[model samples]
Target: MDGKKVILAEPRGFCAGVRRAISMVEQALDYYGPPVYVRKEIVHNHHVIRALEGRGAIFTSSENDVPEGAVCVFSAHGVSPEVRGNARGRDLRVLDATCPLVSKVHQEAQRFARAGRTILLVGHADHEEVEGTLGEAPASTIVVESVEDARALDLPPDADVAYLTQTTLSLDETAAIIGTLRERFPALAGPATDDICYASQNRQNAVKALAARSDLVLVVGSANSSNSVRMVEVARNAGTASHLVSNVEDVDVGWLDGTTAIGVSAGASTPEFLVDQLVDRLVELGYDGLEIEETATENITFTFRPVWQTEEVVQP
Candidate 1:
C-alpha cells in the first residue's frame, strides 16, 4: 500500500503504577546492593524483569526462596496475606511495590469478607493478580472469569454477595459480568469505586479509537500481561484485526502486507523503548507516516512508601 502509516495510541505504555514499581526495584538494587530478592514477575513483563535481573534483582516465585533478612520487594500485582506472612516469618526485609489500585481490590475483598458476603472476583483465575486477590479471602471468595461463569454460580438469588474485579481487565467485559451478577442477585454489593484500574480503561478506550480508523492494531506487551491482551481484544471487538507484539521480532510481515494504517499501543507495564523499536521496524518496512491517537491524557504518578527509600525494613 502507498503511504502506509502508523497510528500510535496516546497514554500507552508504563502507567504510573508500573513506573513506581520498577523504580522501587532499581532503587532497592542501588541502595541494598546486588541480589535484592523480588517475589513474582515484578509486573508481568519479562523485559522489565530481565533488565532488573541484570542489575542484580533476583526474582523468585516464592518468598521462601529469599534468604532470611534479605531485601524483598513485592510485585506490582501484589501478594496474598499468606505470602506476606511467610515473608515475615523468614525475617525478610520487605519493600512493598504493589500498585495502589490492586491493593484497593484486596482491601475490598477483606471488607466484603468481614461483612460475611460471598465475594465474587471477576477476572482470569490463573492471573497472578487474581490469585493474590483470591487469597485475600479464599474461603469466602469465588473467581468468576466470564459472564458464563457468573450465570453458572450455584448460589441462591438472594445470597449475600459482593463483586470485585482484577484491576487490569477489559472494561466492557467486566461490566457484562457484573451486569450478569446484578441480574441474578438483586442485592449484590460492589465496591464504591470501579475496580478496574484507570490505566486499563484509558488504554482500552484508546485501542477502540485506534481500531475505528486502522486496518490492523498491534499491542506491545508480554504474553502474560493481562492489560495488553485486553487491549488486543478491545481492538478486535471493535472489528479490527489485532495482535499482541511482544517485540519487533514478533511482528509477522504478512500481517502488514496490504495494511495502510496500523494502530500501535502498549500495555501498562510495557516500556516505551519496546514501542520505539516496533515503530522503527515499521518505518524500515515503509510505514513511515505516523499519527497519534490521543484518547486520554495520563498525568498520574505513584510514590514509593517511605520505607522503600530507607534502610529500615517494611513490616508485612
Candidate 2:
C-alpha cells in the first residue's frame, strides 16, 4: 500500500521487572564469570535467553540441575517456596530475581492461607508465576482459570475465601472472572490493589488504543509470553487483525496486503531491539511512513539486593 504507516505503541517492551531480572543475570555474569546458572527463561523471551546464553548464562529448568554451591538465579516468573528450599538444600548461591509485583501476589497467597481462607487464584494455572503462587499454600489454594471456572466453583456460599491473580493476566478478562467470583462468593476478599502488574496493564491499554487506529497489529514477543499473547487477544477483541511476532522473521507479508496502518507493540519481557527489527522490516515492505502512538509513559524501575550482599545459605 502506498504511504502506509506503522503506529508504534508507547509503553511497550521491557518493563521494570524484566529489566531488573535481566540485569541480575548480566551482573551475575560480570561478577561471577562464566556459567552463571539461571533457572528458567529469565523473562519469557527466547531472544533474551539466547543472548544471555551466548554470554555464559546457563539456563536450566530446575535449580536441581545447577551444580551444588554454584550461583543460581530465579527467573522473573518466580519460583515456589519448594524451589527455594531445594536451592538451599543444594547449597546454591541463590539470587532471586522474581518481579516485585509477583512477589506481592505470593505474599497474599500466604496471608490468605494463614487466615484459614481457601484461596481462589485467578489466571492460567500452568504459568510459572501461578505455579509459584500456588506453592505458597498449595493445600489452601485452588486455581480459577476462567469465568467458567469461577462459576463452576463448588465451594460453599458462606465459605471463607480470598482471591489473588497472576500479575500478567488481561485486565478485562480478569475482571470478568473476578466479577463472577464476587457474585458467587459474598465473603471473598482480595488484594487492596489490583494484582495485574502496571507494565502489563499499560501495554494492554496501549495495544487496545493502537488497534483502534490500525488495519493490523503485530505484537513482538515469544510464544509462551502471557502478556504478549494477551495483547494480541486485546487487539483482536478491538476488531483489528493481530499477530504475535517473535521476531522480524515471524511477520507475514500477506497480512499487509490491504492494510494501510500497522500497529506495533511488544510484550513487557521483550526487548525494544526486536521491535526495531520489526519496524525495519516494515519499512522495507513499502510501509515506510512511521508514527508513534503514545498511550502511556512508564518510569518505574526495580532494584534488588545482590547475592553477594546476603549471607550464604549453605546446607549444614
Candidate 3:
C-alpha cells in the first residue's frame, strides 16, 4: 500500500447549507448560552453533534422535548408546517436552520399546489425532508421514489402535474425517473430550476470522476445521509466498486484487496476531519501516496450569525 495513490475528490463535505445549519447551532449556544434545544442533529455528522452537545446544545426528536421558551432550532433537513406550528404553540424561540435549498423545494411544492397542479415528489417516503415537503400539501402532492412508483402512480385523469425532487439524489437515476415522468406526462411541469442542489450535484460529479479513475471509491458519510448514499451509487454506476462508510472505523481492511487507487469523497453533512481520518487510515493500510482530483470549485458561503454575536462589534 506504500506506493499506492489515494485520490481525494474536491468539492466534498460541508456545503454552504450544512455550514449555515451548524453555525446556527453554535451561534445559538454562544448567544443564548448552553442548553439551546435543537430538533434534530443539525447535520448528520456524529462528531459535529457531539461537539455541539459538549457546548450545551440539546438534540431532541420533537418540539415537545424542548422546554417552554427554550431556544429551539430546526435541523438542516427542514420541518413540516405542523412541526413549526407545534414549536410556536409551545412558546419555543424558533430559529430555523433549514437549508435554503430545501426550503426552496418546499416553496415549489406550495407554488404548484396553489396553481392547481398535482405535485409529484421524487424522494424516499419516510425521510424527514420528504415528510416535511409532503406536509406542505399532502392532499395534492404524491411521493414517487422510483421509476416503478412513477409508472404505478394513479392520479386524476384531467389533473395537471408538476414534479419536485429531493435535493440529495443520484443525478443519473433521478434523471432517468424524471425522463420517465416526462414521457408519461408530456405536459408535466418541473421546477423552474434544478431541484438537486449545486453541492449535491457537484459531489456526485466528483465521485463519478474519481470512480472512473480509481479502483475503489470510499464515500465518507452516514448511511442515512441521502447525498452520501447517492455518492456510493454514483461511483458504482461509473463501474467502480464503492462503499459508504460513516467514519474511519467503518473501513474494513478486506475491502482494499487488489485495490490500487482509492478515491475518497464525503457527503455535504460530513466534516473535513472525518475525511482526513479516513485518509490516515488508508495510509495505515499502505496507501501512502496522495493526490486530489479537482472536479469543481466551490466558493459559496452563507452568513447568519446570532444576534448576540453581531452586537459584539469591536472597532479596530
C-alpha RMSD between model 2 and the true structure: 1.3
Pick the winner on TM-score between candidates 2 and 3. 2
Residue 108 of model 2 has an lDDT of 87
Residue pairs in collision within model 1: none
lDDT of 1 at 103: 92
The per-residue C-alpha lDDT of model 1 at residue 94 equals: 86
At residue 79, give the lDDT of candidate 2.
87
Instruction: For each candidate in the order shown, give its overall lDDT on alpha carbons.
Output: 0.92, 0.92, 0.89
| lDDT tens digits, residue span 67-167, model 3 | 97778888999898889779877787788888989999999999998999899999989788898899999999899999999888886444599999999
Q: Which stretches of candidate 2 lie over 4 Å from their true place?
A: 311-316
Task: Give the range of the ten consecutive residues with the poorest summed lDDT in model 1.
Answer: 306-315
Best by the TM-score measure: 2
Ranking by TM-score: 2, 1, 3
Q: Give the Å shift of residue 17 in candidate 2.
A: 0.4
lDDT of 2 by residue, 206-279 (tens): 99999999999999999999999999999999999999999999877988888999999999999999999999
Comparing candidate 1 with candidate 3, which one achieves the higher lDDT? 1
